[model samples]
Target: MGSAVLVLAIGVWLVQDGVRTELPPRPSSAQSFPAAAAPADDGRQRATKPSIPGMGASPPIRIRIRAILVDAPVIPLTLDAEGHLEPPPPDDNNLVGWYEGGVAPGQNGTAVMAGHVDNKRGLSVFYGLGSLRPGAEVEIERKDRTTAVFSIDAVEEYPKDRYPSDKVYGETSRPELRLITCGGRFSKETGYQSNVVAYAHLTRAKSA
Candidate 1:
């Protein structure tokens, strides 16, 4: 299907809904690049590619969510015409995009990733993520053969307009990660009416 068709299949009514997603008014030059949705080749796990500033190198990260032992593919944060981050595809319900500007998975501060709870089909990679309870473990594996494990601290659902801006995108000193996707009631007019955000914290790290 075309991009527009695929978008409507989810809840993205407009391709570039938000016009200008200004980065925090700070002294950084990190530009947001649009990440491509994971190919719907199969349920097989694909390696994640990180984006580098100069070389434009593709970096890969390995992630493990202990509660579900999920090994998802991560992509760099990029924006569409509206300047909003581009989302991953609902490939077998798997595919996620990480906001690179926030923080590295194993490093300090919040590391955010966005996924589709479900597609026009029915379920997405994180369809059941809301079921994750506190204390659950979420791991992020880096190419350097190291794994960072995070524990689920909270799972919340928020309205789009009232999304927790500070809490969700705010800076922090501890290494934290947020898994976001569309949730709540659905309508033919709108695929998903709300968003589900799962918050997690780094609890362990080991050489992989």
Candidate 2:
């Protein structure tokens, strides 16, 4: 998808459909990159073990993040007729949307996943995404009966208009993951003012 289309789709689909009385936790400044600094590549080389090889294409079936107690099924997300990527069904708070058009979770490229921060009933799947810290593990179970393990590198919140599409969706020589959700200020008119994105890189993979 075009970067412009992705920006619009994420801004629109990630927001809560109805007013939520309580907002999800926002990523603190300590978790974000310094204003003048760009996202670093050091994390990918920080692994102590020998680098693990990326796997072939295999759709993700589930995602588990022990740090925040996230254990949700992942559904393939496709673009609508209007060419906007679709979000997961609003009624299913535990479901996550995996951009099927992008690289799979275990593949040697950036894989994008998004979840709702909140819904009308209450906090949803990614409500605590901003709380994740470096070194936390995110495990994605794939259709091939393998689990791809990723380590958190950073969590940052950006205004919708200023989101760095290139950093989040850019290609990578190694497997990487991005978990996103609506965050920052909210309004009945605009939904949300910003988005919380968690950056991670694959560390290991194992058979399920």
**What local distance difference test score does each model get?**
0.52, 0.84
Model 2 lDDT vs. the true structure? 0.84
lDDT of 2 by residue, 16-48 (tens): 664477777888888875565444244534333
Off by over 4 Å in 1: 1-60, 90-92
Top TM-score model? 2
lDDT of candidate 1 over 35-69, digit per residue (tens): 33211111221123221111111233755565654
Instruction: Give TM per candidate.
Output: 0.68, 0.91
